[model samples]
Target: MDARLNYFGNQLGAKFLKYINSAGHALGLSSLPAATQELVKIRASQINGCGFCTDMHTKDAAHAGETQLRLNLVAAWREATVFTEAERAALELTEQGTRIADAAGGVSDAAWAAAAEHYDEEQLTALVSLIALINTYNRINVIVRQPAGDYVPGQYA
Candidate 1:
């Protein structure tokens, strides 16, 4: 299927993406574990039903040496035993953050505290920013009906 627009080819869209890409690049330099970052992106993409992002992040994570089993189980992370406590905490926070409108009060203290237990202030900052960023990416892709399943790992890198 064709996308409604070639977002990457459009000049305005390209400029907008450049700034967000810079934000993502800065996040990459943070103390947050790279594995955790990918997992968070995958989970948030899954929650948002952004097939493009789900495809992109899962492939990127796999190319970066993420296990197939773990990547497959990201959506079921709550019941999966493969994840570390910290990873699970981040996933929990991702869910709450992405579904803020679903739950009243917008990200419960429990979720925040759980994430805090696993991450330092700096890492938490990166995590929070990553969640917001991924959600933004998800919305754009879903709105544009970006086609999925053809992304090459590091294609945007």
Candidate 2:
């Protein structure tokens, strides 16, 4: 399957993609743990049904040595025992963040407080930024009907 438009081939999209990529780069330098970032991205992508992102993030996580059990359990993270408390906090935030429209209050105070319990201000900033970034990517991919299952690790980098 082909993208409706090749983002790189279109001058406007190419320019837009530079800013898009910058967001990813910004998170790369953040203190948010790499493993957490991957799980967040994968979970949000799953929630958003963004095939492009789900495939990319899952592959990236695997290449980074993330365990298959952990990756597979992300969708059911609330019931999984494989995650740390911090990872659980991050996952909870990711779910609420991705499903913002599903709740009237946005992310619940409990979720926010829970994330704060695990992450310092700096890591919190990164986690929030990462959630926002992956959501943006998910929306873009879903909107464009981008096909999945072909991403290679580091292809975007």
Q: Among these predicted structures, which one has the highest lDDT? A: 1
Compared with the true structure, all predictions reach lDDT values of 0.97, 0.92
lDDT of 1 at 82: 100
Q: Give the TM-score of candidate 1.
A: 0.99
RMSD of each: 0.6, 1.1
lDDT (tens digit, per residue) of candidate 1 on 17-79: 999999999999999999999999999999999999999999999999999999999999989
Q: Please tell me which predicted candidate would have the highest TM-score against the true structure.
A: 1
Deviating ranges (above 4 Å) for candidate 1: none
Q: Which stretches of candidate 2 lie over 4 Å from their true place?
A: none
The digit string of per-residue lDDT tens for model 2 on 9-128 reads 689988888997887888888888999999999999999999999999999999999999999999999899999999999999999998999999999999999999989998999999
- Write down the TM-score of every candidate: 0.99, 0.96
